[model samples]
Target chain A: AQSVTQLDSQVPVFEEAPVELRCNYSSSVSVYLFWYVQYPNQGLQLLLKYLSGSTLVKGINGFEAEFNKSQTSFHLRKPSVHISDTAEYFCAVRMRSKAAGNKLTFGGGTRVLVKP
Target chain B: GAGVSQSPSNKVTEKGKDVELRCDPISGHTALYWYRQSLGQGLEFLIYFQGNSAPDKSGLPSDRFSAERTGGSVSTLTIQRTQQEDSAVYLCASSLDRGSSGNTIYFGEGSWLTVV
Candidate 1:
């Protein structure tokens, strides 16, 4: 079974400050990673994903994440944040191949609060 | 292009009653998924439907929960004998058929269900 763990439950940062949300996974098989953001009272939107190729993957809203195979982590980062960036973030994983069911396993989300 | 859409944005039901949530995927999307999000909690995978094939129901919490996708476009998730624990925001997502070629999933606004 694939499991994702988000180390922080809440992160508070001032506007324009750099921020990072840490995520780690435990899975024996190859996996695909994703980061999703949910605005207050809104649905989730994809931030970025890491399937293969470059370990450093850039996403929308000036966010990016690095996939560290040795560390088994995919940490999301943004150079600067805005008040609008306040939201809940989730990290998810899915098996890499068709032989395995491509079902997503999500982590307990980390809530980000950006203050002005 | 329109993203995934869900119906009855908010629903309130009594315990022991049955409730159904509907999801309409994006045009041409062949993969649909159902998930649940509780207050201050992470998203929980509920089910997966690919085209017209039998859905992968492994994430469903119990037999009372079931889902079906018709015509490979719209899906309905039914929870029988709804309990207080069943109250949550039910989310729907869809993705293009990539056959493991790295497709991103788009989500709906979700239907908030409250059981009294």
Candidate 2:
């Protein structure tokens, strides 16, 4: 089984300012890391994912995340945020067990408030 | 190509009533998933269907929550005797088969269920 935790419940930042949302996970087996965003009244949209290879992965809307294996962390970052970026962010993990069938374990979410 | 779509975007039901939500996945996708998003629980995996078979239903909170996929296409999630605690956003997603390289899941807008 895998579990994810987003350290912050909410984060407020000025528009155009850099921001980071912290996430950590605990798993017995190797896992995949993902970051997703949810806008008001909308479904979750994949921001980025770290499956293998490079530790740093870039995603849409200038968002990026780094997968740190030893630390068990996958933190999402953005050089500059806009008002449109104010939404809920979730960190998730999926175990490598084929029997799980790609089921995801999600964090409690971090609400991003990009103030103008 | 059309993305995943869900019906009855908002549903309000009285306690002890029954509710049903629908989802249509992208064409040719063989994997479908259901999840629940609530204030306390955040995002949680509910069930998964590949082709016409469901290999995992362990995430379902109880027997009251049930889902079925037919013809390997559309799916319906039914909640019997819905309670106020069942009020949450029910999300549905599908992918072009998971665990393979470049496979990503797409989500629907989700059905908001508010039980009073």
Please provide TM-scores, in order, for all candidate models, with all chains considered together.
0.97, 0.96
Runs in model 2 with CA error above 4 Å?
Answer: B98-102
Q: Candidate 1 — which residues are off by over 4 angstroms?
A: none
Residue-level lDDT tens digits of model 2 in A4-90: 999999999999999999999999888888899999989999999998999999999999999999999999999999999999999
**C-alpha lDDT values of all predictions:** 0.92, 0.90
User: Against the true structure, whose lDDT is highest?
Assistant: 1
Task: Please give, for residues A1-116, the per-residue lDDT of candidate 1 as tens digits.
Answer: 88999999999999999999999999989999999999999999999999889999999999999999999999999999999999999999988875688678899999999999
Can you write out model 2's per-residue Cα lDDT over B31-100, one digit (the tens) per residue? 8999999988899899988875644798999999999898899999999999999999999999887546
Clashes of each: 0, 0
Model 2 reproduced share of reference interface contacts: 0.61
